[model samples]
Target: MKAIQISQFGSNDVLTYTELVKPQLNPGEVLVKNRAAGVNPIDWKTCSGGGAAPFIGDLPFIPGWEFAGTIEAVADDVEEFKQGDEVFGFIRFPERAGCFAEYIAAPADQISLRPDGLSAEAAAGLGLAGLTAWQALFDKGNLQASQQVVILAGAGGVGHLAVQLAKWMGARVVATASTENHEFLKELGADLVVDYKNESILDHVNNVDLVIDGVGGEVGIDALNCVKPGGTLVTLPSVTKDEVIAAGKAMKVKVEPIRAEPNCDQLDRLAGLYADRKLVLQIADTIPLEDIGKAFDASRTGKVKGKLILTL
Candidate 1:
């Protein structure tokens, strides 16, 4: 099998596309022949010695977490799925699953059957980002219907999905994005779009029940002001600073940082939404598996409007 692996952490040039032995399955695991792999910031960040890099042990590591593929075989303990089943999910996030290769041995409970109408590229894009948005809004933030919410980086992978999910839950959605993407976000069900480049997000919106902060740092810290006195502020990126938590406390608001995990139940709900045409995935670009280096470069630019995928 052909895979992109890194013997050492550095730039995108370090990702080498070469042949590697097909992975063998373990108990309660399924061997998937990957058809598409999502290229997330975590992928490039890990490769450059950031994000989840510390969890990646040894050299010659393969970086990728979200993928969609067909099941080639299953371990003895697995009973829910059989060979030739189409599935998609985030594989063992915060731990290495080596999804950049053609085959991945993922736990059966971490994945679900793909919606019939959903393409492999689209399914690949949904796992990590979709789970991140869903967990941030519903589980951590406790967002409710008819409430107002603000989503930062509305055009991003997680942010875009957050906008749609919030709308589906009947929340009045307000989002921050560049002027160029304002219309795009509105189409995704955002009721109001704040132009982060030209206008202050705090000035345009206030007294929101929840704020999903996808762009952590000073921006995420500033979003604390957008929430109401008792509202919650959920930060998605693990890179959130300590000051954000302190600031939220001072403001009498709940501040939480979230890391998306593998959840087959949540993935099933997202897949149902896709089947009903209530959710849509935006694909910024799809590159061949051999050109993963260029995909990393594009992800590093931080300007992609949607998810990038690697087709096998």
Candidate 2:
């Protein structure tokens, strides 16, 4: 099988495309012949010795966690799927799942059947971002119908999906993006779009029931001002500053830092939304497996409006 492996953590140059032995399945696992893989910030961040790097044990590590593929084989304990089933999901997150390859041995419960009419690239892009948005809004923030919710970085991978999901839940959606992306977000069912570059998000929006902050740092802390008293602020990134926590406490707002996990149930729900055209998966670019280095370069630009995918 062909795979991209990093022998050392550094720049994109370290991601080497080479042949490797096919992975063997364990109990409750399935061997998938991957068609596409989602490129996330965590992929490059881990390569640069930041996000999830410490969880990777071996030197030559595969850095992808989300994929869409067909099941080639299944373990003895797996009965939910069979050979030739099309599937997609976030693999073992916060651990090595080896998704950026032609093949991946993933736990069967971590994936769900691919929705009808959804393409492999689109399915691959839906896993992490979709799950993150769904969990943040429904599970953490407890966003409800008719509630006003503000989503930061509305044009981003998670933000774009968050807007649609929030809208699907009947929440009034407000989003922050550049002026150029305001219309794009509005089309995704956002009730209001605030241009973060020229305007202040807090100035344009207030008394929100929930704030989903995909952008961390000072921006995330400042988002608390948009939330109403007793409302929740869900930060997608794993790392949150102490000041942000303190500020949320003082404001009587719930501050929750969320790390998206592998959940087949949530993926199934997202698939249904995609099939119904309620959720749209945006792909900024799709690179071949061998050109993963270029894909990483594009992801680091922080200018991509949607998810980047690696097509095998």
Candidate 3:
């Protein structure tokens, strides 16, 4: 099997396209021949010895969290899927799932079947971002119909999806992006789009029921002023979560930090939504697995409108 491996964590320079033995399945596991893998900010951060690094115990690690592929083999205890089944998953997050390779040994409990209408590219990019948006809006924020919600970094991987989902839930959506992305976000169902660069979100919108903070730090802290009393602000960046929470406390608003988890049920629901055109996953670019470094560089910019994918 060919994979991108890091003998030690540091930078994109540490990633090497190399050959290794294929992974063997454990109980209730399936071997997937990977078709595509999503490149997220966490992947680059983990490789740079920051995000999710502590959970990755040793050297010679493979870094990727989500994948779409076809089943090549299955363990005896796994009866839910068979060979040649198209599947996708966001699995074993904050731990090594080895998704940046041509093959992955995936637990059956963490994956879902990819519907015929969802392409491998869209299915691969949907898992982590989709689950993050779903969990943030419904689980953590408890958003309801007719409520108002604000999504920071609205054109981002998770933000873009969150905008649509919040709208689908019947919430009035307000999103923030640069001037260039305003129309794009409006098309995604945002009733309003604020140019965060030259304008103030606090000025245009207020009394929000939920704030999906994708860009943390000062931006997140400032948005606290917009949430109505008793409303929630779900902060996505772990690095700045504590400070944001402190700010939320000062303003008497609720703040929650989120780490997207694997739920096969949620994955299945998202797949169904994609098949129905109620949900869509955007791919900024797709690079070959051998060019993993290029994908990492693009993700590092933090300016990508959508997800980056690595084709296997």
Measured with C-alpha atoms, the lDDT of residue 133 in candidate 3 is 96
TM-score of each: 0.97, 0.96, 0.98
Show model 3 residue runs off by greater than 4 Å. Answer: 93-97
Among these predicted structures, which one has the highest lDDT?
A: 3
Supply the TM-score for candidate 2.
0.96
lDDT-wise, the better of 1 and 3 is 3
In what order do the candidates fall by TM-score, top score first? 3, 1, 2
Each prediction's RMSD to truth:
1.4, 1.5, 1.1
Model 2, span 1-312: residue lDDT tens = 999989998998898998988887888999999999999888999998988887888788988989999999999999999999999999774244489989899898899999668999999999988999999999999989999999989998999999999999999999989888888889989999988878888898888899998887789888898888889898876555456777798878889888788888899899998998899988898999899888888888776798999999
Better candidate by lDDT, 1 or 2: 1
Give me the overall lDDT of model 1.
0.90
Q: Model 3, 1-312: lDDT tens per residue?
A: 899999887887899899988887888899999999988898899889888888888878889999999999999999999999999999883234489988999989999999999999888899999999999999999999999999999999999999999999999999999988888888889999999989999999888999999999999999999999889999999889999999998889999999999999999899988889998887889999999989888888878998898998
| Deviation of model 2 at 164, angstroms | 0.2
Against the reference, the lDDT scores of all candidates come to 0.90, 0.88, 0.92
TM-score of the candidate numbered 1?
Answer: 0.97
Candidate 2: which pairs clash?
none
